[model samples]
Target: MQLEDMTLEELKRLRKDVEKAIETYEARQLSEARAKLEAQAKELGYSLETIAGVSKTGSAKRLPKYRHPDNPTLTWTGRGRKPKWFIDALESGYEKKYLEI
Candidate 1:
C-alpha cells in the first residue's frame, strides 16, 4: 500500500499502527538488554541493583555540601545540576567556601 495514495483517515490509522509497532519493538529490546545485564551481573557475584548502585528503597542520597547564603533552609548535595541560588551566588563572586555548610 502506497502512503501517498492513502486518505487522511487511513494515514492516521497507519501512523498509529507504526507507533504501536515501534513501542513493542523498543520494549522487547529493552527487556532483552536488562536480562543480559542481569545475567552478567550475576556471573560477577553481584545483583543488577548493586551493580547499578540502587537499593530496594532507592539510590542513597548524598549529604548536602552547600547551602544558600541568604536562605538557611535551602541546601544542595552538590551532585546533579547546580541549583539556581547556587549559580547566582557563584556569578555574584561568592566562593564555594562561603556556601559550604
Candidate 2:
C-alpha cells in the first residue's frame, strides 16, 4: 500500500510494526553474535565470562554515607535517589555533614 493512501491509524500501526521488527532483528543479531563468540571461546578452552572477568555473584553492597539524625537506623549510601528522610532533613535546614555516618 502507498504511504500517501494509508490512513493515520494505519500509518501508526505500520510505524509500530516497523519498530518491533527492528528490535526483533537487532536482538536476533546480538544472540547470534554472542553464540558465535561463546563457540569460539569454548574451542579455545575458555568461556566468554572468564575472558571478560564477569562474575555470576553480585557486587558488594555500598555502606551508608549519610544517616538520619532522628532515627539512626535510617541511612543512605548517597548514590541513587535521596530517601524521604534525607530530603526532609535537607528541607529542614540540616546540612549533609550533620547526616554523615
Candidate 3:
C-alpha cells in the first residue's frame, strides 16, 4: 500500500508489523547460520566456539591427588610435569605412594 493512502494510525500499525517481520526473519536467519556452522565444525570434530578460537568459560579445575606431608596447602593433581616439591621429595628417598591423598 502507498504511504500517502494510509492514515497516521494505519501507518503506525504497518510500521510495527514490518518491524515484527524483520525481527522474525533475523531470528530465523541466525538459527540457520548457527546450525550450518555447527555442522561444519562437527566435520572436524570440534564445536563452533572452539573452531572460532573461543575458549570455554566454565572449564573445570582439576582435583588434587597428592598433598605435602607437613603442609596440607601444598597439593598437586599430578597431571603435568612434576613440581620442585614433588621432585625433591622423590630424590630424598620418598615414594610416590606416600603422597597419595
Candidate 4:
C-alpha cells in the first residue's frame, strides 16, 4: 500500500503491529538460544536445572573470601555482594577485593 494513501491513525496501527511482531520474534529467538545452551550443558553431564542453580548461587565450587584492598575491614564472599558495596565503600572508604583467578 502507498504510504500517502494511509491515514495517520492507520500508520500508527501498522507501526504498533510491526513492533509487536518484532517483540514476538525476539522472545522466540531467546527461547531457542536458551534451549540450545541447555541441551549442550546436558550433553556435558550438567542438567539445565543444575546449571541454573549454579548460576543463581554463584557457583557449585568453593570460592575464597576477598577483602577490600583499600580498607582491610570489609570483606566479600567472592560472589559480589548481597547489598551494594560501592555506596558503602564510598561512605566508609573501605577497599574491595575479588578473586584474582
Over the stretch 7-65, how does candidate 1's per-residue lDDT look in tens digits? Answer: 99999888866654543453345446667988999999999878778665546665466
Model 1 C-alpha lDDT versus the unseen true structure: 0.71
Question: Across residues 49-101, which tens digit of lDDT does each residue of candidate 3 receive?
Answer: 78877665667555466655545677797888888887886785556766655
Error at 4, model 2, angstroms: 86
The alpha-carbon deviation from the true structure for residue 83 of candidate 3, after best TM-score superposition, in angstroms, is: 0.9
| Backbone clashes in model 4 | 2
Question: Over 4 Å off in model 3, which ranges?
Answer: 1-58
Q: How do all models score by TM-score? A: 0.41, 0.42, 0.42, 0.34
Query: What TM value does model 1 have?
Result: 0.41
Candidate lDDT scores, in order, read: 0.71, 0.71, 0.68, 0.53
Give one digit per residue, the lDDT tens place, for model 2 in 66-97.
76766667879788899999899778656665
Q: Model 2 TM-score?
A: 0.42
| Poorest lDDT segment (10 consecutive residues) of candidate 1 | 22-31
Which stretches of model 2 miss by more than 4 angstroms?
1-58
Question: What is every candidate's alpha-carbon RMSD to the true fold?
Answer: 16.5, 16.6, 24.3, 14.8
